[model samples]
Target: MLDTDTIGYLAATFTTTAFIPQAWLTWKTRRAEGVSLMMYSIFVVGIALWLLYGLLSHAWPVVVANVITLMLASFILLMKIVYK
Candidate 1:
Protein backbone atom coordinates (compact mmCIF):
# COMPACT_ATOMS: atom_id res chain seq x y z
CA MET A 1 0.00 0.00 0.00
CA LEU A 2 1.16 3.49 -0.65
CA ASP A 3 2.01 5.64 2.35
CA THR A 4 -0.08 8.75 3.06
CA ASP A 5 2.56 11.13 1.86
CA THR A 6 3.00 9.10 -1.28
CA ILE A 7 -0.68 9.30 -1.99
CA GLY A 8 -0.64 12.99 -1.26
CA TYR A 9 2.18 13.48 -3.69
CA LEU A 10 0.41 11.46 -6.32
CA ALA A 11 -2.70 13.55 -5.94
CA ALA A 12 -0.68 16.69 -6.06
CA THR A 13 1.10 15.57 -9.20
CA PHE A 14 -2.11 14.83 -11.02
CA THR A 15 -3.80 18.04 -10.08
CA THR A 16 -0.82 20.22 -10.83
CA THR A 17 -0.16 18.56 -14.13
CA ALA A 18 -3.75 18.97 -15.17
CA PHE A 19 -3.27 22.72 -15.26
CA ILE A 20 -0.37 22.52 -17.64
CA PRO A 21 -2.41 22.25 -20.81
CA GLN A 22 -4.32 25.44 -20.16
CA ALA A 23 -1.17 27.28 -19.27
CA TRP A 24 0.51 26.00 -22.39
CA LEU A 25 -2.38 26.94 -24.60
CA THR A 26 -2.56 30.41 -23.17
CA TRP A 27 1.17 30.84 -23.49
CA LYS A 28 1.38 29.51 -26.98
CA THR A 29 -1.60 31.36 -28.33
CA ARG A 30 -0.63 34.46 -26.42
CA ARG A 31 -4.28 35.15 -25.89
CA ALA A 32 -6.28 35.10 -22.72
CA GLU A 33 -9.63 36.26 -23.97
CA GLY A 34 -11.40 33.27 -22.50
CA VAL A 35 -9.60 33.58 -19.22
CA SER A 36 -11.25 35.66 -16.57
CA LEU A 37 -8.97 38.22 -15.00
CA MET A 38 -10.81 38.39 -11.68
CA MET A 39 -10.90 34.64 -11.32
CA TYR A 40 -7.23 34.17 -12.08
CA SER A 41 -6.36 37.01 -9.75
CA ILE A 42 -8.26 35.38 -6.93
CA PHE A 43 -6.80 31.98 -7.79
CA VAL A 44 -3.24 33.30 -7.65
CA VAL A 45 -3.82 34.77 -4.23
CA GLY A 46 -5.39 31.55 -3.02
CA ILE A 47 -2.51 29.50 -4.35
CA ALA A 48 -0.04 31.78 -2.67
CA LEU A 49 -1.88 31.30 0.60
CA TRP A 50 -1.86 27.56 0.06
CA LEU A 51 1.87 27.67 -0.50
CA LEU A 52 2.33 29.60 2.71
CA TYR A 53 0.16 27.13 4.55
CA GLY A 54 2.09 24.21 3.17
CA LEU A 55 5.37 25.80 4.21
CA LEU A 56 4.18 26.45 7.74
CA SER A 57 2.70 22.98 8.14
CA HIS A 58 5.68 21.10 6.71
CA ALA A 59 3.59 19.32 4.12
CA TRP A 60 6.07 18.48 1.43
CA PRO A 61 3.46 17.41 -1.08
CA VAL A 62 1.46 20.54 -0.49
CA VAL A 63 4.56 22.64 -0.63
CA VAL A 64 5.78 21.13 -3.87
CA ALA A 65 2.38 21.07 -5.54
CA ASN A 66 1.46 24.55 -4.50
CA VAL A 67 4.83 25.90 -5.53
CA ILE A 68 4.49 24.59 -9.07
CA THR A 69 0.82 25.38 -9.23
CA LEU A 70 1.47 28.87 -7.92
CA MET A 71 4.01 29.44 -10.65
CA LEU A 72 1.69 28.22 -13.37
CA ALA A 73 -1.27 30.05 -12.00
CA SER A 74 0.72 33.23 -11.60
CA PHE A 75 1.88 32.97 -15.16
CA ILE A 76 -1.65 32.61 -16.37
CA LEU A 77 -2.71 35.50 -14.22
CA LEU A 78 0.03 37.68 -15.62
CA MET A 79 -0.92 36.74 -19.14
CA LYS A 80 -4.50 37.59 -18.40
CA ILE A 81 -3.47 41.05 -17.27
CA VAL A 82 -1.11 41.66 -20.12
CA TYR A 83 -3.45 40.36 -22.77
CA LYS A 84 -6.37 42.27 -21.36
Candidate 2:
Protein backbone atom coordinates (compact mmCIF):
# COMPACT_ATOMS: atom_id res chain seq x y z
CA MET A 1 0.00 0.00 0.00
CA LEU A 2 1.14 3.50 -0.73
CA ASP A 3 2.00 5.75 2.18
CA THR A 4 0.20 9.05 2.72
CA ASP A 5 3.06 11.07 1.33
CA THR A 6 3.29 8.81 -1.65
CA ILE A 7 -0.39 9.26 -2.29
CA GLY A 8 -0.01 12.96 -1.96
CA TYR A 9 2.81 12.94 -4.45
CA LEU A 10 0.82 10.90 -6.90
CA ALA A 11 -2.17 13.20 -6.63
CA ALA A 12 0.06 16.21 -6.96
CA THR A 13 1.77 14.80 -10.01
CA PHE A 14 -1.50 14.22 -11.79
CA THR A 15 -2.99 17.59 -10.95
CA THR A 16 0.17 19.53 -11.74
CA THR A 17 0.88 17.75 -15.00
CA ALA A 18 -2.73 18.10 -16.12
CA PHE A 19 -2.10 21.76 -16.86
CA ILE A 20 0.64 21.01 -19.36
CA PRO A 21 -1.49 20.43 -22.43
CA GLN A 22 -3.40 23.66 -22.02
CA ALA A 23 -0.22 25.58 -21.34
CA TRP A 24 1.46 24.04 -24.36
CA LEU A 25 -1.48 24.78 -26.59
CA THR A 26 -1.61 28.36 -25.44
CA TRP A 27 2.11 28.81 -25.94
CA LYS A 28 2.17 27.25 -29.37
CA THR A 29 -0.84 29.19 -30.57
CA ARG A 30 0.23 32.36 -28.86
CA ARG A 31 -3.37 33.17 -28.28
CA ALA A 32 -5.40 33.39 -25.12
CA GLU A 33 -8.68 34.61 -26.42
CA GLY A 34 -10.48 31.76 -24.77
CA VAL A 35 -8.70 32.21 -21.48
CA SER A 36 -10.32 34.38 -18.88
CA LEU A 37 -8.00 36.98 -17.40
CA MET A 38 -9.89 37.37 -14.16
CA MET A 39 -10.01 33.65 -13.54
CA TYR A 40 -6.34 33.11 -14.17
CA SER A 41 -5.46 36.10 -12.06
CA ILE A 42 -7.43 34.74 -9.14
CA PHE A 43 -6.07 31.24 -9.68
CA VAL A 44 -2.47 32.43 -9.62
CA VAL A 45 -3.01 34.18 -6.33
CA GLY A 46 -4.62 31.09 -4.86
CA ILE A 47 -1.75 28.96 -6.05
CA ALA A 48 0.76 31.33 -4.49
CA LEU A 49 -1.03 31.14 -1.21
CA TRP A 50 -1.09 27.36 -1.45
CA LEU A 51 2.65 27.42 -2.06
CA LEU A 52 3.19 29.52 1.02
CA TYR A 53 0.97 27.23 3.00
CA GLY A 54 2.96 24.25 1.82
CA LEU A 55 6.19 25.93 2.85
CA LEU A 56 4.88 26.84 6.28
CA SER A 57 3.49 23.38 6.87
CA HIS A 58 6.60 21.59 5.59
CA ALA A 59 4.61 19.58 3.07
CA TRP A 60 6.99 18.54 0.37
CA PRO A 61 4.35 17.26 -1.98
CA VAL A 62 2.34 20.44 -1.75
CA VAL A 63 5.47 22.53 -2.12
CA VAL A 64 6.69 20.69 -5.17
CA ALA A 65 3.31 20.57 -6.84
CA ASN A 66 2.52 24.20 -6.16
CA VAL A 67 5.96 25.29 -7.34
CA ILE A 68 5.51 23.73 -10.74
CA THR A 69 1.85 24.67 -10.86
CA LEU A 70 2.66 28.24 -9.95
CA MET A 71 5.21 28.50 -12.71
CA LEU A 72 2.86 27.09 -15.29
CA ALA A 73 -0.08 29.12 -14.03
CA SER A 74 1.96 32.30 -13.97
CA PHE A 75 3.15 31.71 -17.48
CA ILE A 76 -0.39 31.30 -18.65
CA LEU A 77 -1.48 34.39 -16.79
CA LEU A 78 1.33 36.40 -18.33
CA MET A 79 0.47 35.12 -21.74
CA LYS A 80 -3.13 36.03 -21.17
CA ILE A 81 -2.15 39.57 -20.39
CA VAL A 82 0.34 39.87 -23.19
CA TYR A 83 -1.81 38.17 -25.75
CA LYS A 84 -4.77 40.32 -24.92
Candidate 3:
Protein backbone atom coordinates (compact mmCIF):
# COMPACT_ATOMS: atom_id res chain seq x y z
CA MET A 1 0.00 0.00 0.00
CA LEU A 2 1.16 3.52 -0.74
CA ASP A 3 1.82 5.80 2.19
CA THR A 4 0.00 9.09 2.49
CA ASP A 5 3.15 10.99 1.68
CA THR A 6 3.75 8.91 -1.40
CA ILE A 7 0.21 9.46 -2.55
CA GLY A 8 0.60 13.13 -1.90
CA TYR A 9 3.79 13.24 -3.89
CA LEU A 10 2.22 11.52 -6.85
CA ALA A 11 -0.84 13.72 -6.75
CA ALA A 12 1.29 16.80 -6.43
CA THR A 13 3.58 15.81 -9.25
CA PHE A 14 0.79 15.18 -11.71
CA THR A 15 -1.41 18.11 -10.80
CA THR A 16 1.35 20.71 -10.59
CA THR A 17 3.16 19.54 -13.69
CA ALA A 18 -0.05 19.62 -15.70
CA PHE A 19 0.14 23.38 -15.99
CA ILE A 20 3.59 23.45 -17.49
CA PRO A 21 2.61 23.32 -21.13
CA GLN A 22 0.02 26.04 -20.89
CA ALA A 23 2.44 28.23 -19.02
CA TRP A 24 5.22 27.60 -21.48
CA LEU A 25 3.00 28.24 -24.44
CA THR A 26 1.66 31.43 -22.98
CA TRP A 27 5.12 32.66 -22.10
CA LYS A 28 6.60 31.68 -25.39
CA THR A 29 3.85 33.18 -27.48
CA ARG A 30 3.29 36.20 -25.26
CA ARG A 31 -0.36 35.78 -26.03
CA ALA A 32 -3.22 35.19 -23.64
CA GLU A 33 -6.13 36.07 -25.80
CA GLY A 34 -8.02 32.87 -25.15
CA VAL A 35 -7.26 32.85 -21.46
CA SER A 36 -10.04 33.97 -19.22
CA LEU A 37 -9.08 36.61 -16.73
CA MET A 38 -11.91 35.91 -14.29
CA MET A 39 -11.18 32.20 -14.22
CA TYR A 40 -7.49 32.66 -13.58
CA SER A 41 -8.12 35.33 -10.97
CA ILE A 42 -10.34 32.96 -9.01
CA PHE A 43 -7.94 30.09 -9.59
CA VAL A 44 -4.97 31.90 -8.12
CA VAL A 45 -6.97 32.82 -5.06
CA GLY A 46 -7.99 29.20 -4.63
CA ILE A 47 -4.41 28.08 -5.10
CA ALA A 48 -3.34 30.54 -2.42
CA LEU A 49 -5.89 29.13 -0.03
CA TRP A 50 -4.76 25.62 -0.84
CA LEU A 51 -1.20 26.62 -0.07
CA LEU A 52 -2.32 28.03 3.23
CA TYR A 53 -4.16 24.83 4.01
CA GLY A 54 -1.10 22.78 3.15
CA LEU A 55 1.07 24.94 5.37
CA LEU A 56 -1.30 24.51 8.26
CA SER A 57 -1.45 20.76 7.76
CA HIS A 58 2.30 20.38 7.19
CA ALA A 59 1.75 18.71 3.84
CA TRP A 60 4.91 19.38 1.90
CA PRO A 61 3.59 18.04 -1.36
CA VAL A 62 0.49 20.17 -1.23
CA VAL A 63 2.51 23.19 -0.25
CA VAL A 64 5.05 22.68 -2.99
CA ALA A 65 2.48 21.95 -5.66
CA ASN A 66 0.36 24.94 -4.79
CA VAL A 67 3.39 27.19 -4.74
CA ILE A 68 4.50 26.13 -8.20
CA THR A 69 0.95 26.22 -9.54
CA LEU A 70 0.39 29.64 -8.05
CA MET A 71 3.49 30.88 -9.80
CA LEU A 72 2.36 29.47 -13.14
CA ALA A 73 -1.19 30.70 -12.74
CA SER A 74 0.02 34.09 -11.65
CA PHE A 75 2.27 34.24 -14.67
CA ILE A 76 -0.66 33.45 -16.89
CA LEU A 77 -2.73 36.01 -15.10
CA LEU A 78 -0.02 38.56 -15.63
CA MET A 79 0.16 37.64 -19.27
CA LYS A 80 -3.57 38.09 -19.61
CA ILE A 81 -3.28 41.51 -18.07
CA VAL A 82 -0.19 42.58 -19.97
CA TYR A 83 -1.14 41.19 -23.32
CA LYS A 84 -4.78 42.12 -23.18
- Residue-level lDDT of model 2, residues 1-84, one tens digit each, is 899899989999999998898799999999999889999999999999999999999999999999999999999999999999
Best by TM-score: 2
The models' CA-based lDDT, in order, is: 0.92, 0.94, 0.94
Local lDDT at 42 for model 1: 91
In angstroms, the error of model 1 at 82 is 0.9
Give the Å shift of residue 32 in candidate 3: 0.5
Using lDDT, give the best candidate's number: 2
CA displacement after TM-score superposition, residue 81 of candidate 2 (Å): 0.5
Tens-digit lDDT string for candidate 1 (1-84): 999899989999998998899899999999999998889889889989999999999999999999999999889888888888
Error of 1 at 26 (Å): 0.7
Ranking by lDDT: 2, 3, 1
Q: List the residue pairs that clash in candidate 1.
A: none
State how far residue 62 of model 2 sits from its true place (Å).
0.3
| Number of backbone collisions per candidate | 0, 0, 0
Instruction: Indicate the worst ten consecutive residues by lDDT in candidate 2.
Output: 17-26
- Against the hidden reference, what TM-scores do the models get? 0.96, 0.97, 0.95
